[model samples]
Target: MKKVILFAVVLFGALIKAQDKTDSQFKYLEYDIEKIQNLYRNNKVTVKEVVEAYFKRINDIDKNGIQLNSVITTNPDAIKIADSLDHLDSKFKNKPLFGIPVLLKDNIDTHDKMPNTAGSLALKNSFPLQDSYLVKKLRDAGAVIIGKTNLSEWANFRGEKSTSGWSGLGGLTKNPYILNRNTCGSSAGSGAAISSNLGIIAIGTETNGSIVCPSSFNGIVGLKPTVGLISRQGIIPISSSQDTPGPMARTVKDIAISLGTMAGEDKNDKKTIGNTPFLHKDYTQFLTLTGLKGKRFGYVKGITKGANKKVDDLFLQTLKILEAQGATIVEIEKDWISPEISKNSFELMVSEFKDDLNDYLKSLGKNAAIKNIDELIAFNKNNKEELQYFGQEYLEISAKSNGKKDKNYKKAVTIAQKGSQQGIDSVIKKYNLDAIIAPTTAEAWKTDLKNGDNYENFYSSSSPAAIAGYPSITLPMGYINELPIGISFFAGKWEEGKLINMAYTFEQINPQRKVPQFLKE
Candidate 1:
């Protein structure tokens, strides 16, 4: 009896110690990609253990504690894949993203059991026939697809007055900072999950503010790369002219590391072919603490005026930091994106969306839930949950459009391309500027279940970059009323390297981002 009691006590103590160790990993959640890799090198944590810990965090924080609802589905094979990575051959040991677990927005297809629902119930069981080009690249770079994230249904182009983070399938993704606040749209889960430390990195697709807005609201670093930098081969379509997947993480360093692996020409995306010259095999080489020195950045006017005055105050403080770091800040007029350009860009996207969407759905073969935009609209009408909050106005409009072959599409694309690209080009040339800096978007607004997105009263600097297909980076500047505000650096096509360098320097200097409080609001 004494021996048995002793054995039981010993086992209980060991379990308590183990629980304590796991509980102490709150700090571990803030670790960047490089730190996690370092932990792997030192054998302090195995890849399997790392993934398991994230699973715990997701269950406790995302699904249970406050129910962030950021993750739509977790990869069932993540642990098995991580274990295999732990036993990888010597040649595969040094891969850039070896053993790193990443989350993909649900819109991006994965051949694995996980479905690419794009946060819609209609295709909740739809798995891709193959991995997306970006996923293929990430997998090759030693990254593991740990799961798919919740996103704005149809990437927020589905309907009129649609809420940013609400989806028919995954529910609404709340801001990590304040549980009642929004996570912005489209890439909503990527931003929330990264900020909440659910995953080390995530991929978010953007046709406009989707990537940066979520990142800004969640207080993380997000990059919307040049349209061709990352292939859109298996992603659910939005605007073919504007859509591209980009990396989201807590630090700019991880962004650079991830970008290197994802950038390459692919036969599936012909736009990538012409941009191959701009692709860097290793982008981390461009990162430097002194990168801000001797660089000229144009600061756009009226961005801070878009919303809270506190953000404007923060922007001014950032300008002082930039000058102190040896950067020349020049005030640039906000004429780079005109109303005419915005109108034309929207027209082109409407047509391209119908055409591009049909192509992706057809690519899924006969098992696809619904075949085209027309079917999608009809599905929403029949399913009450799909229209519980908003109507599919955009899908209806796209169904009525003539598609890419339409004369209006050609005219819109031509004008949108020439006007937007040239507008940004002419300004940069005149000012001899390396990039244009502005507020990424307003601080996140309160999530509205009935009225939909409340960003109309807020400022957003995403259109110029999105329409022109330029690269842009948004990083935490500071916070306003506990919500984070982000500063953006965007410029000509293929300037991702320059943007990374500058954003990294600012990040290191300011370092304002902090883990969310999950405030009850």
Candidate 2:
């Protein structure tokens, strides 16, 4: 009888401990960087303690309870880094993100022991020869690099019909709001991690919709800055003309903070050599609750109308709020990019993928697999697990192309540039618009490996911005069922500062974000 009583007591104790841990883990899942910073300043929490708590939660829930699979590899050096930051002199306290933990989507290069695998087994143990420019900037700014997060293998550029966010190395990243829903593609982990509070913020790169799509699905703010605003030096490339790194976070203010730190010139990246003066040192100042006052924003009505009735209603609510705040709303009936431009974007990506990837591999020295595109295709064919889900149809198509020498490629580039500039830019100018607004994307759809990306009617916001290399930001507006949706604001070329200002204002006025309750009792 005594043994039975002792067993019952032990079991009860274990259950209580489990419950406590679970509750604690989910406590700050919705807290922003500012709230945590204030807490840390008041001695309510230590950086080291916060870092440890998040790591524990990630281990327990990320791939276990919720099975989100958002994180690719947790940094073993994270605790040490946080401890070092915590003990820094009082002067470091002023740093907006000092001791804040951040995650990087796996494709970004990290010089640490972590693998820059891009969610592929091809580079399973391969590490970068050097840190990516953005990673270097984050570490220098006193932010603790928490971990590498999962992504679509090869940034969803390998195959024609590849599944977004699924890779042989890290598996699929599930949306936090609903465990069964998709987290979208490419920079999938960045969105899921930030939305679920696995980290304060994350860095995600995009050739097209990778950052915004995942951000929309996960209900966070994602900013794809002017292509040259943030250096893409060490990142794996798709199209140098289009690929750029940006911030993904739960709020617009956090995104601004991240972009401020990362925007600048790098000696290694010639594209940013003359762009340092444009980077903002303090972005929080742009967060005026009344920023929407008197600003004329164009509504790309065509794309915003495609989301389900519920989503459209939510977007309409947001539009109404903007109007009430004294912002002028204008409907744009004819600003669509030509289909020819779209075709060009794809062609340019293919041409650059072959050249840029080969260049990157060569820079990897000895750790890289299959130096050129041909070798990579051959390697994938031989490795079933890495290439089984989707064949390298894009790669095969790219391989057959004449590369940069094709006249068709040249014409496509011209068309894309003109359509993005003359078409989208002219419309913004004609309307005297501060920004162009449209639906970022629809709600998260169910993931189907048997099929491909469940892409429905996403606004073609990415094209004009991407081709023009302009700045664009997307913020969560509302949810459909439990799956969240978002709307985007596109700023004219090299106008990230203005874009951030407007986005911050909108976020302050109408904060629609919330924490995900994945394992509620």
Candidate 3:
């Protein structure tokens, strides 16, 4: 009788202990960087405890509950790093991103146990020889890299009609807002993960609309910095001129904090050589309540109208708010880049991709899974899964090209740069405007495998900035049927400071960010 009573008592105590442990882990869950840091300072939590909470949340919401499928593979060394961080006094000193957890888009290389697959089965087990330049910056600033997130395979440069978030190695990543809706590539995972609070912040690479489009779809903030602002040395490329890694987070302040750490000179990448003068040591210094008070913004009447009424209506409402905030909005209809110039810029991307991808593959050394584009195309032909959804028509076209050696490559570069760069500069200078504002893109599309990426109106202004290698920011404007739409603020080169101040002001005056419920269709 006594033995039975003792067993019952012990079991009851054990259950109570487990409950307390769970509560401790969750007390600081779903917090932003500032809040998390405050919790750490108050001795309310440790870095390891916070990391464990994120892991639990990821497993519950991402892997099983709603099945977000955002994370590709988590780092084995995350907990160990957290432990090391906790051992120090003045944990926040000199570490701007001290103990913050981040998720990286799969293409960015990390030399750790985690493979930088870029969502291809051919390179599923491919580990980078060294950390990418930005990854090194993150680690140095004391941010813990938790995992690599799924991206559009080859950063969505693979197929003629490629599905955004579908990859051969890491299957489909579902939209957190509505499970069936698409998360735009190739930063799809970073955007979705940040939306679902899988990590406090995420880093995603962009060539054109990759950062802003996903951010708009997922209800987050993303910044595509001036091309030379961040290093492109270690990142897998789409176009050397257009490709840039940017930050995405729930709040504009968080991205500002991250950008400060990410920007610097990369000796290997020549674009960043003379970039020191343009770089700001602390981007958060620009955030102010009255940033947009004296600024002039340009908008086109035809761009956001007549497509989807809800998106247009929301954009119209946004304009009223900007006007009320002491800023003047100007009409600049028919001022954007022409179709022919845009087409030529695209051809340049195709030309650059072959040389860039081959260079990256060769850097992987002797034991890489796929040697070059030829091997990748051959592998795709043999593998059923790689060709299951879409045909690799883009790869075939790129493979036959002579890259920069071709007669038209230099001409294409000149036309693309001259048209895009001048297009933005002329407009900004003509009207004496601070920046250009437009709808980021149409709302999230339904994820379809048979027919890929059908859009309603498909309005986007990312190309001008992208082709020009300029800076742009996208933040949540409003939602249509529980789907988020974003508004963009873009300007000529090295205007990131002014852009951040403007975006922060807009977000502050009228914040529309909403948390995803992971609803099923």
Candidate 4:
């Protein structure tokens, strides 16, 4: 017994020493996907080395240094998968995302060991039978499925006053820019992780501000594509009308590449069937440094005014840059989007959440922790940790909803679709615009569990496009006291190409993106 104990102690000490050495070796490795691929091709590094480096980085930063808690789980088989890819034929290595490590928001399904929990304790043990449609596409493109990320429980739709990045299963994901500030949800982990260089790329879903808001706060590029562009078949549900997965990354070029890999029609999702005309297998083809020239853009000044003064000043500079590039700017009125549309959209989400969530639970098979929302609510009530910060008020409200058959629900859907679509269409027609521009969201607010989100009258440009099922892209604009802000470009349905071009041009001209300093209060 004494001899065995001595051997165990020595082995554990060796493991700790090795981990410290690995962390120090790769602490400053560059995270650009193209650069990493070139190194692999030159035989200067292997896929396994990259995977191991990322794992070491995650351990150092996410698990220990700042305790970001951004990553919910890391793939145990990532090194093995990378080794297999490294051995593939040279011709096969030419894939768009060859050996690139990618992270998925927890709501996305994967048949691997990780659970699709959506940051909820109730579904912590549930495992899906297959990968999401986009996941399969990503795998086919030779991207490595790194792991799942933390999010707001149930994608921030669970309660009225809940905190953004706090989850029962994974805890709170802190903003990498400033430790005490919030990383907005429901794509919280994806934004923070990507900003901190934990992974090369990550996939995040947005019902409204989930992707863009977090991206804005964390200083990254987030693209919420038109609803049907990426199939939502295997993802845990929110509202079927507005839920879509998007790419969140550090560069527009990287986002363009990832968008191409994930955009396609899926047999399980009927909404994607007729979207072939808008789908592009190589979206990077449209990226140009001169894309802003000769393009007419509508500036939505109302929603852009109330944010930080530094952000506002930066936005004005951005407009000047566009004008210098020979792009026309049309100023738009404040009341572009109707109040009725906002009201109806909220009502629609309430009704759809019940129907969609129940269906998703049924799809999880009989082994799910909680079968439905009612059970989920009960589980939370019994588990104090789930309700330590906020109650499941939204879940309670959704459970009481008259599933999809209500006349009000139908009316709300029609009005929401009509209002949002017309609101964007009219502006484009009036200004002969390629897209509309606005600030993506407010600056990173202080994480306040007691008082909830510090944004009392927060106005986002994401809502109109989200409601219309249109594409919108947010890129880093500038900083306010080291906290990042973002500018958004959105357009009519299936106008992803236009938005991408405009955003890429803006990125090339300004190039203001900054890495996080991990400052603590």
Candidate 5:
């Protein structure tokens, strides 16, 4: 009788202990950098405690409950790093992003135990020897590198018919809003993880729609900074002309905070030379609620053609909100993106992909699983896991392409850059506009691995900004049937501050962001 009683007592105590460890309060704690800093300032939470809470949330919600599969691998040294930060002098506490946890898309090199696979099984064991330029910047700012997030395999550049968020090694990263819905990639995991509050902030690299599209679908703020604003030194390549790493976060202010820390010139990446004059150490000064007042915005009407009627209705409603906020709306015709530019853009990417990817692989030394596109194609064919959902047709096409030295490639680059830049420049000059506004993307489509992505009635304004190598910011605008949609603000080169101001203003007024319910559709 005594033994039975003792056993019952021990079981009850164990259950209570487990409940304390996975406390529900910590699970949904809003760990935004500002909130976290406030807590730290008040001595309410230590950096180690914050890191532990995030880990607990990841274990409970990400690993077990909804099984987001967003995180590829967590840093084993995260707690240790946080502990060291906790011991920092009070003077160092004022540093931006001090002790905040950050996740990076798997494509960005980290020179740590985690391999920079870009969601490919081929490079699953390949560890980088040096951190990427941005990673070094984040670390210097006292950000606790928590983990790497899954991304679309090869940033969705490997295959013709590919599903966003599906990776050979990391598997499929599901939308947090609705479990069955897709999180658009190749920054899908970064979008979903940040939306689900798995981490405070995440970094996602974009060649085109990779950052903004996923951010829209997953309902977060994603900033695709100007091509030169952030270095692309160690990121896996799709197109050297378009690829850029940017911040994904729950709020525009957080995006602004991250940008201040990350935006700087790198000696290794020549493109960053343009950023020298424009870089600002603190972007939060531009976060004004009155930013939209008296600002002139050009509305791009052409891209709304294939959008859902309800989404278009929301867009119209948003226009009214902007007008109410004292902004002048100028309707611009959709004559900017010419067919020739669109056609040449793909050719440019193919040429750049072959050239850039080979160079990236060469940086990995002789032991890289697949050193070049030809070897990558061969390896994908041999690996059943890689081809289970889609074939690497894009890889084969890129492999057969003439390198960047081709005259056709050079022509494509000039045409693409000139056309896209003129597209935005013409509209801005014509209207004397501050920035252009358009729907970031359609709602999150259903995840379909068998037929690849079911992109139904989807149109995006990302192309113009992407091709121009300019800056664009996407923030939550509204929702349709529980799926979130975002509105994008894009402008010319080195105009990220203006875009950020406009986005932050809109965000403050609208405040349409909602936490995902993890519906199991």
Candidate 6:
């Protein structure tokens, strides 16, 4: 017994020593927004060096030290892109994200040499013919396209019992702060990679809580802009009404900058019309630490009755911070809002997912996997590893849906729009609130492949914003254990500027963002 105890103690000590060494080896792992900016300003780090550091980190931690499985494929043109950016910077450093390395969730199309596979082998070697509007914007801003990150296969829309971050092509993307914990879907890799310092920032697409949930789980900032604020063109779609790509970054400022660059009208997406006014060429102008003053936030504490005690406590602490920051807090009345509309949003998603996805697949040209909803159902049945972990119960449910024409779907949509919009718009009109505040979700629970997600109470605060075609942003408030919980601020359609100001205010007052320490037991 003494010998066994002695061996255990020695082994534990060795493990601690090794972890310290690993942590020290990566100096740029936990860089702040200003620190990286300063490094760029002073020429202490070249674009090539920064991109190379991330690549080396990916090679070491992603494939070696931790085997995070966060990335699907490294960009073949990364070095060339970096070199070209260096020359451009030498002549004129006009680009905002000049030389900064950014990762893409596999669902976002890139016309580069790298293929955009949404973590499915079904799209292997199937590169799109054109760059997404967001991709073009990133290039224009002089950002380096580093690699594609792993995601929940088909963006977590395919299955009911699906794992949040698992992809057959790229495997599971482990949370950087805690290896055993989940990185939440469907933008799991984008969140995990940013949290792990694998990239400066990443872009993620959301239909429902895809961006915000993963951001909350991974302890980062996720911006789910107004439906038409960012173009859905070239993005693998779940719902055209709900699907919009936005930035995931370690800081609100970084997220703002990326969003500003990415927001614009696209010929491919007609819905983006009249978005030019919302697209600020300089979103950084709104980032002020003192912006929290005189702001009104609608607190949805009613949703927290059944939440985790630890998460609730953290949330209360966040409320205190907001109060101290000179913001007005008002409790949401139960009668003003109900859960019925939130439930109906999912029904609308199911019907739209079928129709919207088929159109997207057809746009992908020949040699693409399953071109329509029926074909997708068949393909999932054929692929065991991809479909086995999570049965396509939702897809099957969606298959039964009659696109947009079903009377049931129409009723669901009408109820959703009326119920959610009435609840939100009435409150906003009555109180004249700048934004409504609520928890993005309860802190992420442990990942369970066998049983699926353990979602507690999340107010579905985003549903009103999503259905209303408005904007929402989730920022890390505090943590429950090592897991991060986020506070969301939402506003009505075309009110992105107001939402950004409010979110920026809260972010400045509460700078509780921290790098996760991955402690292995």
Instruction: Please provide, for model 1 over 1-521, each residue's C-alpha lDDT reduced to its tens digit, 9 standing for 90 to 100.
Output: 00000000001111111112333566566888889888888878889988988989888878887788999999999999999999977678689999888999999989999999989999988988998888989999999899989998988888777888889999989887877778887899999999988999999999888898899989999999999988889999888888989999999999999999999888989888877788898999878987688989897655655445666778888889999999999998866667888788888888999999999999999988899888888888899989988998778877898898777998999888788888889889999998888877666776777987753455677887788889999999987767788999988999899899989888888798887877764
TM-score of each: 0.94, 0.92, 0.94, 0.94, 0.94, 0.92
Evaluation by TM-score, superior candidate among 5 and 6 = 5
Question: Which sections of candidate 1 miss by over 4 Å?
Answer: 1-27
Candidate 4 residue lDDT tens string, 50-157 = 888888888888998668899999988889999999999999888999989999999999988888999988888889988888999999999998888999889988
lDDT of 6 by residue, 201-270 (tens): 9999887778888898789989888888888888887776668888999888788777778888887798
Reference-based TM-score, model 6? 0.92
After superposition, candidate 6 runs with Cα above 4 Å error = 1-20, 32-34, 89-91, 455-460
Give the Cα lDDT of each candidate: 0.84, 0.78, 0.83, 0.83, 0.85, 0.76
Clashing residue pairs for model 6: none
Better by TM-score, candidate 2 or 1: 1
**Residue lDDT tens for model 5, 316-427:** 8999999999999999887867868767888899899999999999999888877898888888888998999988878888898887976799899989988999988988
Error of 1 at 391 (Å): 0.1
Candidate 3 lDDT (Cα, 0 to 1):
0.83
- Candidate 1 vs candidate 2: which has greater lDDT? 1
Name the regions of candidate 5 deviating beyond 4 angstroms: 1-24
In terms of TM-score, how similar is model 5 to the real structure? 0.94
Candidate 4 residue pairs that clash: none
How high is the lDDT of residue 295 in model 4?
88
Which regions in candidate 3 have their CA more than 4 angstroms from the true location? 1-26, 91-94
- Candidate 4 off by > 4 Å: 1-30, 302-307
The residue-by-residue lDDT of candidate 2 on 94-177, one tens digit each, is 686788889998988889889888787787887888998889888888888989899988888888556777987998887777
Candidate 3: residue pairs that collide? none
State the displacement of the C-alpha of residue 176, model 6, in Å, after optimal TM-score superposition: 1.7
